[model samples]
Target: MTVSVLVPSSLTREAEDKREATRKLGYVARAAAVFRVDRLVVFPDSGAEGRWGDGFVETVLRYAATPPYLRKEAWGKRDELEYAGVLPPLRVASRTGSGSDDSGSLRQGIVTEVGSDGRVRVNCGLQHPISLPEPDEGLTEGERVSIRVSSRRPVRAKFVDESPPGFVVEASDLSTELSRDDAGVRIATSRHGEQLSVDRLGDIVADTAPRGTTVAFGAPERGLPEILGVAPPGGDEGGAETERERTDLPADEPDGSRFDLWLNAVPNQGSEVVRTEEAMFAVLACLSLTE
Candidate 1:
């Protein structure tokens, strides 16, 4: 299933420094990679943005998701990437074995040249670019493609009609993101939302697993209700209330956001607060469960 994770641009609002901000973003990227998320979206939260805004968060997240070998080619020098050094690596599932194996290994490659003779030179993290017969559907230079390598000695490989591994980072507003054609089961995670119990999670997964899933997380301090200008259950300013106590508040009204459900993924938290990165891991872990 396609899984899209949404985090506010003010995700690092709690970070004290650039280094810590970058490190926190690394864990977010790692969580996305671990869950095999299809898209990592950064929604605007201008009010809560700290020193760095969406630009910094998007740049760091995109950099962290890109494979080390493809970083230089994918993104060149940029002023927004000054703190890139502090970004931790996301060891995503990509081609690991050398092309020596006969069974073939899946690898992502960028087209360097598309020859008239139906051949294209691809650089798939190899010592040298390899020339292979292009697929019937033509290819263009700078286009990313997937290839399966059968042998390294002679470099036997062929193009595979499949999506490349890892997720793509994007920046968009919450409304626009939810309006996408592929946007499915739009869930908003909050500490004051409906308590996600074991019995309820099954129905949630069943409903969302078919089309896809888009789960949104709030900032460290500001939650979705505040970000969206809606009064959270049991008032907007206070410590998190127990699930039983929250049920007594008024039901959630459509706050102009397209969220299908507001879920409290961590129902019985021992701590007073949950960081965005921590919430990402916890919420995704629960949603990723299968029947």
Candidate 2:
């Protein structure tokens, strides 16, 4: 399934310092990798941001998502990545079957310099930048592209038309991402949504696996209900249940709602508040069980 994960840019607002914030995003990146997310979108939540703000959040996340070999070339020195050292390594899984590591594999690279002739210099995590002919679509400096590496001893590689391993990172507006034609089953995760149970697993997997799914999450303490200004389930009562609660929302049928389901993926949450990274694992672990 084509999974898309959305996190508010104010995700690190509750962190005590840059190190803490950067570390938190590390786990978030790990969650994306573990779940094989296709796109990790950072939606704007500027009003609730801290001193780091969205810029810091975006920069660090982008840096973390970059493959280790291409990192130095892709992202040079940046004030926003001061605490990037705290980020945990994201060991994105390998592709099996036909394009397995045994055979030639595709790797993501950043164009260091575009040549005037018909070639461009790319840093694909080799000893040095290599030269290759530009694609029919052409290439630009700083543009990321996929390269097929056949042999490392002789350094045989070429640019190819395909996505490399690992999830992509980008920033976007919540509405726009949710509105995408391929957004699949949109889910908003909160502590006050429908509780998920084993009985419902079959239906959810059958429904979302084929169509793909897009899941949105909020910052620490700021649940999806608060982010979208929607009252949590039973908000009028003593309070909404701290479990997997849900609401009906269909992408094709946008009933003035931001998501197709307001899902409390983690039911009977023992912790008073689940960090965004923790929530990602708890929520996605269940969703990942799809064909």
Candidate 3:
């Protein structure tokens, strides 16, 4: 079997955008390897117009040229995708105000460092200093601590205090620490999942940036199961241990070949591709079960 790369011109307009598109294509290629996909398609989308800083197609080629995870396989054909999906516009909202409450709140800050001592310092962009929360009842320094902060008003922030209250709990308390540096300051984003550095957006560090922005892109073929190094859903004895790997997703088709072929024709719920990615994913998942 052979593997292929797909690049939609619409996704890549500038040098950076083009590069990103290539990376996405490479990701798909890698996913294809995992799923053993043959005859991949490269479709270009020209949804982007004069807004592109540099030539979109050229930019995509530059970015795509970078070796992706699945670069091991050589891409074959190149085509144009008539319509994939309508990607929403990018909106960056300003952070202002100070007064805050529960109804309307969000966490804002700049991550300074991931401490070797197990403490994270964040500059909440507030005038006051917020205290760090106890990692866990038994959390010690050098241990990873997760924190979640939300903006109350514009400038004011309310740290989600998950710390177990000591005998003497107060109405107002700090959950994380902050410090000033040459670059500017450091602040915590959230502690529950991955500890993100809000100080840096994209690849560089900046003092002021939008609280957060969502980007729409194709989902990686290798998902949680692969990252965790687990086998597909069939309860493979040689797979890693994860809840998702053990569960079977609802499939639109049952027969392995027909289902897989059918799915390839649809786009996902969000994307307008003929066959939804979700359906294909569903079929792939069932195939994994049998594997």
- Per-candidate TM vs. native? 0.82, 0.89, 0.22
Output the number of the TM-score-best candidate: 2
Give the lDDT of residue 116 in candidate 2: 85
Tens digits of per-residue lDDT, candidate 3, 25-62, equal: 33333333344432233322233432332343333332
Instruction: For residues 236-287, write the lDDT of model 2, one tens digit per residue.
Output: 2323342123342233534434666667777887988888999999989998
* lDDT of candidates 1 onward, in order: 0.80, 0.80, 0.28
Q: Whole-model lDDT for model 1 versus the true structure?
A: 0.80
Give the lowest summed-lDDT range of ten residues in model 1: 236-245
Residues 1-291 of candidate 1 have per-residue lDDT tens digits of 679999999998888888888889999998999988999999888867888874888888988877787777777897667678877777776654544542466777888888988789998888898999888888889988888877788778888876667898988888787777788888888887777888888988888889899899999879987787765644533333432333443366333355777788887889999888999999999888888
Off by over 4 Å in 2: 96-103, 236-257
